[model samples]
Target: MTPKLVAGIEPPYYTAVFTSIRPDAPEGYAETASRMRRSVEEIPGYLGHESARTPGGIGITVAYFRDLESLDAWRLHTAHQEAKAYGREHWYDSYSVHIGRVERSYGHERA
Candidate 1:
């Protein structure tokens, strides 16, 4: 399936891509994930995101922000820090985070 798209988002933004392999017994994982989404939205410069997971439990979530400073704030958010620790200790078998500037973007849609 296609990952859910972030509607109305424009370029010159920042995107944080998080990729992870799930642990077998991922208790409280869903709850924490939901909270992280909500928390980032409350942050000053959050834009939106697209997320998807494979049947094998490999997942990717790319969240967008207005700038690197906003992205940096989200990274340093206390709750996010806790969630990162939790993923490392309990939920994810492995993970990687990549951040980049969206220099330009173009798309097409069929009506």
Candidate 2:
């Protein structure tokens, strides 16, 4: 799949970097992930996100927000909280989350 890069965002935003290694039997993971993605879009101060996964079951999703408050809102979201619990119990073998402030960002695209 082609990655959907979040464009037009300036510096000083925040990012929640979620990296996970899924188990072989990841039942219900795809549907729940899709639901979470759609739910996040409706949140206030949500900038955008980029995500990808490897055939080896290593996945990464980086979600951007306008500030710490917005990121906190996502963390406190009921659906998100539920998803996290489910992921811990069923889907993932291991996972890590890192929150960071983006001081600067640059990239290149070819036409």
Candidate 3:
């Protein structure tokens, strides 16, 4: 789905990040993660996100944001807060978050 970017005259600023974690996860972790991914897409300023399992089947997801404020809103969201607690309590063995500025991006189209 296309993101609903905030209506502002300023050019968009993006944050690009990828996270990897250990494989000690709860049962149905993959399914739950899929649901989580879909939910993230519903948030405002959520450009898109995708994840894949590593060679060892550890999960990695890259989340996109339209701006720093959008990123912070996602970080502090209530349900997201609960999921984070759950991850710490039962789901994830360990995980990481990386924040960065997206200086440039390009898209391709079929000729």
- Give the candidate number with the greatest lDDT: 2
Question: Clashes in candidate 3: how many?
Answer: 0
The residue ranges of model 3 lying beyond 4 angstroms of the native Cα positions read 1-12, 16-18, 22-25, 107-111
Alpha-carbon lDDT of model 2: 0.90
- Candidate 2 lDDT by residue in tens digits, 48-96: 9988789898989999999999999999999999999988988888999
lDDT by residue (1-111, candidate 3, tens digit) is 644432332335565465656565557666766777777777788777656667664776777787887888888877778777877887666777788776656555445
The prediction achieving the highest TM-score against the true structure is: 2
lDDT of 1 by residue, 1-111 (tens): 544467666778999999989954378887888898889989899998888788898899888999999999999999999989978887888899999999787767657
Rate residue 81 of model 2 by lDDT.
100
Clashing pairs in model 1, backbone N/Cα/C closer than 3 A: none
Model 1 scores a TM of: 0.89
Question: Clashing pairs in model 3?
Answer: none
Candidates' C-alpha lDDT: 0.86, 0.90, 0.67
The CA lDDT at 30 in model 2 is 79
How close is every model to the real structure, measured as TM-score? Answer: 0.89, 0.92, 0.71
